[model samples]
Target: MPASADADLTTEFERLSLPLADPFTIARGTTETAENVLVQVSDGSHEGIGAAAPSTYYGETPATVEAVLPDLLEVVEEVGDPHVRQRIDRELRERVGANPAARAAVDTALADLAAKRLDVPLYRQWGLDPAAAPTSSFSIGLAEPDETRRWAERAVDEGYSILKVKLGAGRTAERLAAVREGAPEATVRVDANAAWTPAEAVAKTETLSGHGVEFVEQPVPADDIAGLRRVRDQGAVPVAADESVERATDVPSIADAVDIVVAKLQKCGSLRETRRVAEIAQARGCEAMIGCMVASNATIAASAHLAPLFDYADLDGSLLLDADPFEGVPMSDGEIDLAAVDRSGTGAVEVDE
Candidate 1:
């Protein structure tokens, strides 16, 4: 039996309304903070940590997560070994209902604990090479032209080579132009957050291509597969599906419509599921991108384990926060320094209060 097998375990969590460095605005709305819940799982000796950021867009909130956590804790308590992470993840999903963020917290915590028991980092435990991971892109949420320009400038000054600019605020052309003006040499990727019609997306893609944009993400609503295909087929830049592809099963259906599929831990429910989505993208001949909700260090660290499998990475969720309760993976010069991750488990440990 594994060392973690049959070990007694306990779970603990806390609600966090983490402030952002600036108000985060997108096609949906504007928010001043990221609402999250942090969870820890322990087996007397080894401790593992995870975090969940609930999005109302996904029908989840801090309250819903808090409401479902007790049942999730009960389910986790029944597990004999944290190493059976996928089995535990499935059980949690069955017990927790439509709470992917909650399930992500539990899954990450258990995966962390399992890696801790083996005294290795989660990526190494998964047999991933940190050096093989691509550099992550810093995000510039929708803002005034000057403000957007400043964000892009700062990102470039900090050595970020790629900029992920949020569009779809009715000034798509102005926003993209402003960002390009701010960091003229930086590679750019625009996310419309499903705000455009197929025709609008196609037109904007041509305009944006001239500004040096590398790609466009979720140009239409999630359910509009035909619209997505229209944009992908007609646009100059490649189209990446974000809201359209949530599960591995959703991959095949949209594979022909997108050049890339964006996978997020909260949306996929577990690292295993996220990997499955990446594999599906690969099998379908589409590039894979790893994305994240506004999250804490624990979540970033956990997601970084799978960074090697992606063609693009937008995992700067923790960097957007006003304060991070933990630190694991180090982001420097536009890349997540996977070499800096030498600690055990998911390598996320809370800062001193």
Candidate 2:
């Protein structure tokens, strides 16, 4: 084992249930309960914590994520060296197959423990600063036009400058118009969650363009590469890919179609993998946006560490929760206080005992 490896460190996993104020609906599925997996690593002194949420987009349910906990813990216990850890991380993902969300939970915990061991924050490991946290957009799930508009207004009033509206149940135009009317000065973006056909996507983009919408996310299905390219070519607004760009392997194939790539730790399977996706997206001339599933402060705090490396962000998952477990990353008028976690590791304050 390498000198930096902590062979004595112990790992444990837990499941938590958090509630969402309203049902969160996207193309993949609906979420009313925030199903989270937390990883704790102890060296008999300081402890490091990391989190993840099971996402339906990746075929993950709470039960599935929970069921895989024992295997993930075994991998953590067996791996020690950082390089070996990284390789083990990859192998574990393959071993577990398509459970990216579960893989992410373990990977993030390992990274957090490594950083904490060195007394360095996770962002610094990725060449980011804790004092300068990233800004992120809050999401507005599918709702009636009036309700959506009111929600947008409330978000703006609460100091959120960017708003991501969930569309794709056939009211794209109405919703966009309502948002525009309610928060004219805010940066508004729409995500269709792959709910539209190519033709409908183009038509909806045309209708939404006049509202000064920032961009449209995954307007077409993830499998339709040609459709995404067509939407990009015809639409005045930029097209971003959420569901389409899942892994580093998928980056090259869809590079031309997407203007932005949303990187979620759950989708990419780890902080290392998520960083690789960001680098790949940037190299391919596509902007990167770090996002999260409906998660709590622990995962959101982890995502915030990577926010500065991206051009756009949608990481305010904690804000959507009815109650968050930990003290959340501080935000002031739409910007994260990067200085909060200037220490090593995730900078997560201890959840109340």
Candidate 3:
């Protein structure tokens, strides 16, 4: 388990299709299934696992991730050192700048492997305190007002106190009202997924404020920084930047325009970049939220390991699955219990089907 600059490593990957517990709909689209690519790296003794849940919104699909993973894994093997994660991440970025999810799979696998070598959980490897991690929020994908109410009620019954309700244009107010009616005491947040114009966003925030909405995420389109600023300047509720902020460098540019920067591991390319995004968001006087796509624990676990650095977390990706192929971090009542991760590495391992 000792570190080696000239270590020998092997890598491989396979496709992972996960069925959603319910058809997940957002403003952009609906998903009954999630396509992911699982990446594995080994040093003959220990194997590290990770998966990429590619999103078309980010311009990457399972096909794209599968196509680029070989090249990305080649970078990992070429580096020949699991501990030199920065170098592997750098080369992966230099090799393929577009497929952040693909690069993320490789980087996560390597991090898991390296952490295994050190015999410590990833958060411990990063010198983070488990208790500092914020509670994660459960998501309620866009559905009918009655159905949305049922989802909220179910979530509350399952011990989730925080809810992230996805909203589109039609019947949004009714849906949120149902959520409130169902779980009146639960903390509520809404994500428009950039489905609205600036004016529409402002109006929605006014309406959402009445429903006790904590904030609105990606109210306007990704390219509309001015629209974001307009909403922030005029809306009753504060705004969060999800599509608007992709990486660390992006945070500074959009920081003045929004109240929160949402960082996802796959979107940011690697764990390091996601951390950088968090740091920059904090430094820029914006709150940081760690989020993830509808993914398995393979990648979500690694993302959760960085939760101590963020002000908010929406890492219920695996929780939304009908079942997950891999197991990683465990969430209880929405709190990502990093302290419970006794296994070395990220605690992400494929379970028997």
- Tens-place lDDT per residue, model 2, 223-320, is 99999999999987899998998888898888888798888988888887888888999999998888888887777777777877788878878777
Identify the candidate with maximal TM-score: 3
**For candidate 3, which ten residues in a row score worst on lDDT?**
1-10
Give the candidates in order of TM-score, highest first. Answer: 3, 1, 2
- Candidates sorted by lDDT, descending order? 3, 1, 2
Error of 3 at 224 (Å): 0.5
> Of models 2 and 3, which has the larger lDDT?
3
Model 3, 18-44: lDDT tens per residue?
999889999888999988888888999
Collision pairs in model 3: none
The Cα local distance difference test for each model comes to 0.87, 0.79, 0.91
Model 3 TM-score?
A: 0.97
Model 3: CA > 4 A from native: 1-7
